[model samples]
Target: MPSFTVVTTAQRYEAIVETGALARLSEFLPSPAAKVFVVTTEDVWQLHGSTVASALSGRSWHRLLFPGGEARKRLSSVEALAEEMVSLGGDRSSIVVAFGGGIVNDLGGFLAAIFMRGVPVVQVPTTLLAQVDAAVGGKTGANLTSGKNLVGAFHQPLVVLTDPSVLHTLPEREYRAGLFEVIKHGIIASEPLFRLMQLERPSVLARDPAAMQQMIAESVRIKSEVVSADEKEGGLRRILNFGHTVGHAFEAETSYTRFLHGEAVGLGMKAAAHLSRLTGRLDAPTCQDILDVVDAYGPFPTLDGIQTENLFARLVNDKKSILGRVHFVLATRIGATEVAAGLAPELIREAIASTLR
Candidate 1:
């Protein structure tokens, strides 16, 4: 096994990712003395919660199940979870185990960060997106009527346990949605990882457990390295948001129902790539190269006509925007990325249009 480490001031922990880590979460958590609670989606609970409970068969465990999807990452759910923990006699020593995908991890992490001012939290990420992105960084938040992840806080995890075997349960579209992040990590950081992704056959990504583990581990390493250098998203940390600017807007415009995070990001990256090419920062071939990788996974729905206009309006409201100008994350080339602010709205509209074609 290749020993990898991402050292950061934000307390870090090793992830023993394998087929059965969910059952072993009790051992991975701090101790049985601490008041423990789990927050997960009903779907995830039905699929693997019992096995996880069985793992801690001899211990006391509290669970709160919520509806699945980005829609549930809200203040109401957080409020409910806070009440749940409080009713369980939770104190400062309590811990919230996030036991689902990004929505659960983000909300649970934020809840753990704020409830009782602060408490330790464990992340048992069951999806590829959570294993690589959401679970690694301390950044946690929820959506609002204005935008997605508009309400959130930054609270690091006590530990992140990744079980690749759980990924097998992901729907085909969901699994393909996560590949966008795997491609993004390579685009922003490691050249070797990028090349490996380019050479991967569909069968390998779909069926090879060892390959899946390595992919998740390497993607986590990229995000962890960046987060370690700038824990609070100062300077170099923003590079991780390469495709998120427009990605979030696409998510919000659809009310987060049409596309998953990765799928929206896949389209957003293509828009960013087109902007790069139009602005002469990247060659036409580079734009096509980015599209090739994104298109390889699955067909993304078109965002055209009035929806395109609406997405641009949503961008204006994005937290990253300032003084009515949007800060767009674009690429200088296939393996390079750049951020530009005060971009013309007309140009932004044009970029969004290109993706639909």
Candidate 2:
């Protein structure tokens, strides 16, 4: 098993990544809790619920299903899940097993945090995206109509169990979407990781076990180290939001319907690279290096129908923005980034426009 510990001021937890790791769920949660709620989506449950149920066969557990897809990740879903927990006799000692992709992880984590002033959560992320990014960080929340993750909280989980085997069932589009985060990790912190990604592209897309495992493990390690240093996104951790500032705005402007989260982030990375070049922080060659890696993984969402003004309007509401100024993360090089604040809105618009061209 490949595992790492994420230490934050609030709590410390281990993220376990390996094939068939889901079968060892009981070992991870040794305590006999009052009850356990396994929150997931109907699609995911249909595929792997039996295995999950078998893992917790002898325990007091219940499976709670939510509608799948980004559209259903809303505050109302959180409220409903909380209500379900209460009706099922949940208490402070209960545990929440967030057992799907990012949406379930966010919803379940938020539910555990506020259900009874917080309960322990165990993240069992199914999709590649969830395992690599969303599940590791304590950032949890449902989206509001206004923006993505605009209503989330910083609630760490008791443990995060990532079974790489589950990813074999992931659709190619979703798997590729998850790869964007791994590429982002490489671009933001590790040149070696970036080269590895470039080398392993075929095996990664083929879902080769060793290749997939290494990608997931390395990505998690990078995220764990960053979260440990700045768990709350106050400083160094903000770099992890590399393409998210604009990526998230794209999601919101399109009503979360047009692209998967990773696809949007892919487009955002292109815009960020363009901005980096335009501002002279990164030369054209390095900027193209970043763009080439992003384009390699993308048939990214088109910006044809999306308006720059609408994107700018949504950008203003980004959590990273403050006092009418957006805090943008721009790469100085392939493996480095810096936060640029108070960038004129026109500069961002022009960068986005370049993407359309």
What are the Cα lDDT values of the candidates? Answer: 0.79, 0.87
Clashing residue pairs, backbone N/CA/C < 3 A, model 2: none
What is the C-alpha lDDT profile of model 2 across 20-60, one tens digit per residue?
Answer: 89988988885775688999998899898888899998899
For every candidate, C-alpha RMSD to the true structure in Å: 2.4, 2.0
Per-model TM-score versus the true fold: 0.90, 0.93
**Total backbone clashes of model 2?**
0
Per-residue accuracy of model 1 over 1-357 as CA lDDT, tens digit each: 232344567676564556667777888777777878888988898888888888767777788776867667888888888988888898888888999999899998988988999898888888888888888878888878766787788787877888888988888777888888988887777666666667784654665887787777788777877887888876778888888888988887876777888998998888888888888788987688778877877678665533777888888888777686777767886556777887767877898888777
Looking at candidate 2, what is the lDDT of residue 108?
88
